[model samples]
Target chain A: MRTTPAKCSKPNFKIHHRPIISAAIAKEQQIVGENEIQKSGFNFKKYMTEKANSVNKALDEAISIRDPPTIHEAMRYSLLAGGKRVRPILCIAACELVGGNESIAMPAACAVEMIHTMSLIHDDLPCMDNDDFRRGKPTNHKVYGEDVAVLAGDSLLAFAFEYISGFTVGTSPARVLAAIGELAKSIGTEGLVAGQVVDMVSTGVKDIGLDRLEFIHIHKTAALLEASVVLGAILGGGNETQVEKLRKFARCIGLLFQVVDDILDVTKSSEELGKTAGKDLAVDKMTYPKLLGLEKSRQFAEELLAEAKQQLEEFQSLMAVAPLVALAEYIAHRQN
Target chain B: MRTTPAKCSKPNFKIHHRPIISAAIAKEQQIVGENEIQKSGFNFKKYMTEKANSVNKALDEAISIRDPPTIHEAMRYSLLAGGKRVRPILCIAACELVGGNESIAMPAACAVEMIHTMSLIHDDLPCMDNDDFRRGKPTNHKVYGEDVAVLAGDSLLAFAFEYISGFTVGTSPARVLAAIGELAKSIGTEGLVAGQVVDMVSTGVKDIGLDRLEFIHIHKTAALLEASVVLGAILGGGNETQVEKLRKFARCIGLLFQVVDDILDVTKSSEELGKTAGKDLAVDKMTYPKLLGLEKSRQFAEELLAEAKQQLEEFQSLMAVAPLVALAEYIAHRQN
Candidate 1:
């Protein structure tokens, strides 16, 4: 059984075929570290824990065991199964940064997480990635039968929209509708499904390039992330410029998340990652590390982190922007 | 290969274990027939054909072949494949019944169809009903592989919401939000999924009662049907009383649909049904025909149809209610 890593650590630089980082990127990393630490006294770990706890509580309340217990049980089993809650945290953080309270964005936050969970469940199906586990637990299909798992995922997807439209408070219907549109777009053919279809079809094919790789990751991973932040900003009453700027920021960090994930897949052990580490390599799937080399991938992640933070520089409130800055760092540096 | 019946016909009452209809129900059916036909000179077939063509055009335009052709192709294969477009036409009919034009309800009409198509794709998966054909053609999974079929279903479900929120015109955002909420609720644990889980679990269980059977069909079939009409009414600026009345009408006809379907299942051949016939009996699944005798089931259906029509009595415009009246008749009497 795979076990999760105990702590976040630097990427394994001693791995074979990985070249040393250039002086420019090393210097850029140092500047980002100093600027972010000196700008705010925010403790990201505590903030994340608090936000995740609140979101979990809300999710628990939102999807209680009603009639037809099995499907609801299956849905809750996967949904409550632990992750870092990155998407919900990003949603809340973005909302707060744009002058909106947590309550206003809570439904949207839960919505993104539900969509994320649904994708994970379906991706782990026997017909898809065929993973035996997710987030250190038996995958949904392993615990429940595939039929129930599929139904559970479908229920979660539908309920996410229900929860958002039915439970969101303190936001105008127009803004709520806009947020819903963003979310729906992120998961459909033009969004996550688009990437998934391309990725599935491209599997086992040789000579895949950076363009195809980027297209997959951008849609599969970044689309929802971008939606998360955009939804928060929109619900929080952010101005058009603020929403657009934050959108760019989210895009950078979203890609950064994938790059870091690719680096960790090859560098870490199965025990360290909770999931099957090196599975991508086993499947001959393309990744940032495979294309750019490990050191360069790390450098790309750092650059994305820097660019993500740069988008927040005009906010003028160091305190307001600190959580987002730290979130970028977290995405860049998470080990598992 | 299953082939569709060429024409609609009355139920087959000559089968073994089926009794003749009672005089009371026969008289009630005659009264309803007279009331509906005398109220308006509406041509049900032309209205259905025109409405279905319009909805098909909108749906075709809504989900064109875009990037990553496989998933789009799969979605269109199931979505645009021939069906009666009952849900979309119901939406348009309900909209018109409440003084809204077809254009005002077009997006929602397409949305309900999208959701319906998604449910069908997912339902036909190997892990679910495992059917090899649908609508006289190969199932989505049969044509596109299970993985792509799943993704296509997901894409359609998400895109349904996206289309509703992004394309709905001449309606307030609040009404659109309300419609979205209704659509979402109809498919989640409290609605369709709720029924599906119960039905899946109850398969082959001995001594299943009419109540459990009703619960299943209500959620599995009626929920979406109810949402279709309710959404149309809501988006078309219907008053609260009108919407509620239509909701009742939708509920009666929704249950009527499944009851008639159950009756037809044992009475029709695979060719006449356009899909697997007697599969429910083969699996010993709980259905209306199995619970209540076939004749009693038909009598119940007539009662439901009458109650459904009764809900539209106060609409004050016989012309406005004609399409809905015809629609309920179409659902009750459809051969496949």
Candidate 2:
């Protein structure tokens, strides 16, 4: 018999992520016709560490190879840090999910990460967030100083597109072009910039309401998240139906991710959080938990999960689908 | 007729941009061919207004239409200001030159301009050049504040690729991808970032030689200039030889343009130069005139022009090549 909704759902349950695959992975192949509903969920922590190390190596090599060490070094400083490689990993995972290969996704994945890295570098700049720390270490600006940090971010953003453009990804030009377009939209004025603009302006304002908050989080964080999954699906050569479903799942997960981040800002210990805890509270920044009480915020997160799962309902018991499904749930439930 | 290094080539009688195409609106065939070249010269003053207006208009509309206005507005401020659309204009001209087409070149052109615009916006920030004025007006950060300026620059950079990726250019995906890669590499850490780093590090240093000055100018200004022309050629379907030759010409002219700027800093009136004059000197920034005597710098500029024209010699009589032929000379000889 199916477990009760109460039994299946946990508002505060913590998992060591030891089980490896979500429970839905078992049912995937039998239920879904061809989808890999039991795919391994990306280990965000592990993936980040691995990718960060690779990036560091790449940064070091890049520095030695380039004429001007300082500029490349600055770019490398941020690119190598141990931030979540969620964006690039999504690109790879999605490409595989759609039955596409990994080679094509590699460049796109790198590009997305570069763009993401650039954003973080700039965001932590003195004139913006004035952040002294990120990923439990000194921020890019803090380590490299302001000028190099600024230039590094710019370089990374530029390199992102360049990397993707050079990749031997798809056999079709249309698909490649589409991928570039997807990336551009994800990082450009419509996505990151718009979100950043509002966030910067809205700082210290306590009453920013849910709609505005949604707008900020959606563009700032969710756009790239959606793009990441969509890129994966597109890379996988999935049809429009699958793409649509994945996009919706990604969207739900993106929102869930942000809400959880907000909740963690208040609930997580400083050590667990990596960076400063309660910094949001100290700054008076508007956040989900701030506007909606902790329990209600948790409820909103649960709602997002339900919506996300519904998007994948058509795929049923496919093991490949499990990764995304697990990821969405994890976004809501993870402590940090 | 063969005006070689023979008889003091085109002496103080250097050509001026006399747009020979009185029939820009004539038959499509005429407008499509060598005739278009007549209208394609570096009319920095004229192109600046139109290109600046259309691009800024699109930028303004894009930002103003966002859900929250502040962020977009901040981005819009610096972008809308008038500056020589040298890089973008070159892209279009090069595209038109090779393919007799502008359609495929427009997106690349726009992307190049967007990237260039972003650089300027950030260059004006407190952490970088910290200039109060740009193109005779308040720098982006000065007018919009540092935070907004940073976001605006970031927004534009991301949007640059998006514009190219989403274009209806009907060019080969390979060429488009290649151009994007070039753009990314040129602007990213390997090129621009490296240049900016050196520029910042060398500030207040006395008696930096010509080599260091060349390093800064090449990466800071010439990399993108070279990319602009190369991107145009690649997208416009020029043969490899043509593409390479144009890159050489662009590099020469790019450096010459900066050399002229440095000279202007020493010589031109503030009103004539538009922006604050002699700022480079104030910061002990190295410039051509500082390393090489003024007369020697002027001679060097002239010599660079000769080299640039020589690179274009293969296409000299093509008539379509005349604009660039004249344009390179203008870079060295311009009053401001």
Candidate 3:
């Protein structure tokens, strides 16, 4: 089997191409070494590029301009707007990790991204965050009138579920239903909406603490991320245990992604990311950097990365988890 | 069985309690003439009250205030705000017409109502129609602020599919998935969103003819009502042909409901319906009364009612269709 020892911090650690141990054996071993077999050969940049391309193509084809050219145009404009497609890629990777193929998970991958895009569009509305720009361009409401933008957001969201349930093929009905349920729960009041509401109400409140901040992030960011991963695994025909493991791993990565984002906001200038830097601080929005100092926030990100990586330990093959591991590292180290 | 021949316009029409013909024979006969035996024993008022009460109970239990109580409170407040519960009743009635009990269709019934309520909440936003009141109470955005109102609408829409897929019992997975797809499609861009966008863009524009007006109403109102009835029939195990026929019936009734609503807007005083009367005329919004004369609008409603009733002629038992027939008449004759 091909092995890449150089990817690991310790010379003794090896990246094995073949299954190293059964999950039960791995549990017994309690695989504890941080320097063990990191499998950096996953080539995350290439994987993400490929996955993003597929998701983008699928999303582009998903919506068409029907009647009332205005709303459809608005929906496609925001939905097809460029973003990293992180949630979808994570979903596809999770599905593959659980012995499922991309065809079975692609519809759901598109769904998560659609939901994410709609949330961003609505969040940037004048009555909401009131941000004029998103992804270095004018927000949806800025391009379309507020009325059309609102309807566009609603349309995208409704289409997400429709595409998933109606367009998915070669999958068991049970799995598809399960995935739909998971996707819905992630966005409703107890999840993304809850986080958004709390964030909106907590703005400029001095008494906000670590717990409240965590609550916001878990709902706003992690809930959807976890749903994406869990849905991929479920639709991929993963057993309950496998789905749960991926959920935990995704939760860690979700929180890690946000922490690193907060860190980057303080560390990078506005020109670097094409977005306003230190805006959270300017608005007195409760963030990891605000609740914990920058140093502690960085430490928290590292801890989350470690926890995310640890969840992958039970996988039969490092190769199977290579993409997920690389994704965690990418979140930890992304420059933008 | 109790029969009320007096309700029929023709004395020759008789209300039959038993199945008079086999489905095959009924299809072959292509029964015509309005003076045929019609089931007049159905008490629409009592049936609607019972179904509405049950649906209200189900919807009340469907959503709960969890964390971030503000959004949940807003969602429930708007959702539980009393309307006639038309969508849910249609769903239940269609299911019964297909020989399925209310238990088989209640989840989908609740889901359609949730979707309807969400649409109303979003439509009343300051950016949309900007209506201050709905169902005789302050609008969601008016009470909760626009930010929370948007989130509340989103939460309800998402929770709708989640509740149907997760909480549904004693139904096949295929039917449940199919119903979810139908519900999503009805509310998406080609459906409710399409209607809303057209209405918003065409506002204050003169020369909107009957075709354009029908286009708006077909999408804005008929789509959800059609979905409600079709989904209920599907969940109740209606064959494809049966479901399709019911879909046609629903389409007619849906259009009829709108035309009557337009007629009432012109004829009723504001005090009668507790809503603004002649508001459509005030805004120059195209309506049945505006395009066609009021007399023609009333005649159009009657034609639609006849078409809707004609679709039910193939049913083996008049008892199965009595409520639906009554609903059509109610739509045609309702003062408000």
Candidate 4:
């Protein structure tokens, strides 16, 4: 309710918070603009700060005391070692936009972070990416060794569910279960594993097509992102219809974000990226930059961003969705 | 109902069902005892056989896809490659005994199998137990190679939740969520990882003490077994009181099972174990039989079995629980 309404139709404003009558939804044709409220994206920096602190607390509480402190320590070290809290912030922002309280989606936010952290841990393992640096520090397996890293990732992944379903909470059990289900699918074989397999197999192959590229991003990066936003909506009290629209919006953004990331890999520097740069090419891995070419990739991202913004036209205001739109834009241009 | 009046009171027969339990739990428990009135042990073999097929079916259905067949194949191979199916069978049987449908508990059953498979797969990795055989077949890493084996374990772990939350209908979402919570804790740093860590570090440390010995098995073996029975009660309509009692029962059985298993490992040949025997000795790992010596380990298992059976006194009928009671006896005596 504290959100601004100045952007209702301002020329300078790229987004508005009110629902648009100009839409492609077949189901919403009749009642398109009636009783529709606009939603703007929330503050990325502020949202990240608040949610990061909360998620850090939950993660800390979740990882403390594993008898032998090695895995717990490694997990905490990787988790707390700072990176932009983009995924959790998106979850919280999406939750807030739909009129639901942030508390309902907090577990989900923490869970997503845990998933991300776990993936990072495994990616850094010697047998995998073998990266020595993460978040500008030595990677988990680099510091803790392969066994500890594997266990750390395993612990984090499991604890993600614990943080949601096991935590004493305000959310309905059904919602929690649904969130868990969505997360499991997204992070599991059909999503993350399939994507990883494709990525792994793509190495040493000369020509990677758009289909395989889409498959990789959809599973590897976008699936969890889509889950985060949709979960936010579910926790935020959105009906099924609203949730579906937001899911589409998030899907576009997630893909766009990754495409931008891939593009940045070709264009950015390690100092600007905060992590190693151009590793994709180093490993001969296929990326959006490789598949679409830089200019075409940028165009593709813009199209996705436009589609994402259009999806938000269903809402009444730009306040709840502005950050998301901005985030997509930022992603499109991010050096990292 | 087919179970008749027993000749006398069998202490373990308190939960006994006539040829299994009353009307309600049969569909859920899957395997029924010979008769309701009979007084006897809670044997798990029948329960294991009955539920194993269905669980494998559910697992197969859960992994459907055009791509990622390699991951699925490895996961399925490890999942169905035999083993007693003890933990999953316990989950289903517990659910049935509580008067819940097996279909409702099927997800939990499959989840346990997934967790168990993950443990086996990881344990078989070169850095871990390094075995080429599990339950009489080539271990996952042996057949699939270490990289696929690792991903396959991860895939199975993720798919467990997907299979459950995606497939089962009519069950309370809260229960499914709660089951996930239980599993995460048991499998995370607090239970399985913690146990494995201690197990890993304790290797070649021949000067291990009793307290350390308890710690290892408590986590490695008991945590999952405790999770198994607890999940059963959750899905089977068990009240908190019943769940708590069953957890205690499971804890005891878990330790006892390990003791017996360690004993059998020393006693049985490679042909009997379907893997190399004397593995603990070979790896110089700490085990119950290693620390306590054979006779003491046997005595300990028997004591634990008796204690486990004693915890079942509260169940309404002995016949319904015969399979479980018999399982306690069999745990101590089984050769493989």
TM-score of chain A of 3: 0.88
Arranged by DockQ, best first:
1, 3, 2, 4
**DockQ of every candidate structure:** 0.76, 0.61, 0.73, 0.57
Model 3 local distance difference test score:
0.81
**Residue lDDT tens for model 1, A195-280:** 88889887887867766777788889989999999999999999999998888888878788898999999999999899999999
Interface RMSD of each: 0.6, 1.4, 0.6, 1.3
* TM-score per candidate, chains pooled: 0.92, 0.84, 0.90, 0.87
Query: What is each predicted model's overall lDDT from 0 to 1?
Result: 0.84, 0.70, 0.81, 0.73
The segments of candidate 2 whose C-alpha lies over 4 angstroms from its true place after superposition are A1-65, A168-171, B1-65
lDDT string, candidate 4, A100-182, tens digits: 76677777888888888888887676666678998889898778877778888887888888887876366677777777788
Question: Which is the winner by lDDT between candidate 1 and candidate 4?
Answer: 1
Model 2 DockQ reads 0.61
Model 4 spans with C-alpha error above 4 angstroms:
A1-44, B1-47
Ten contiguous residues with the weakest lDDT in model 3 chain B: B1-10
Query: Which stretches in model 1 have alpha-carbon errors above 4 Å?
Result: A1-39, B1-39
Instruction: State which candidate has the highest lDDT.
Output: 1
* lDDT of candidate 1 over B56-174, digit per residue (tens): 99999998887888788999999999899999999988998888989989999999999999999998999988999998899999998999999999999999999999999998999
Alpha-carbon lDDT of model 1? 0.84
Against the hidden true structure, what lDDT does model 2 obtain?
0.70
Tell me the tens digit of each residue's lDDT in model 2 across A1-336.
Answer: 111111112222111111122334423422322223334344445644664555445434433436677666667666766565677666666676677765666666777777888888888887888888888888988877787788888778777777667764564766777777887887766688778877877889868776667767878888898888887777668889888878877776777788889999998887898888899889888888888788767776776676667677776435555555555655767778
The candidate that wins on TM-score is 1
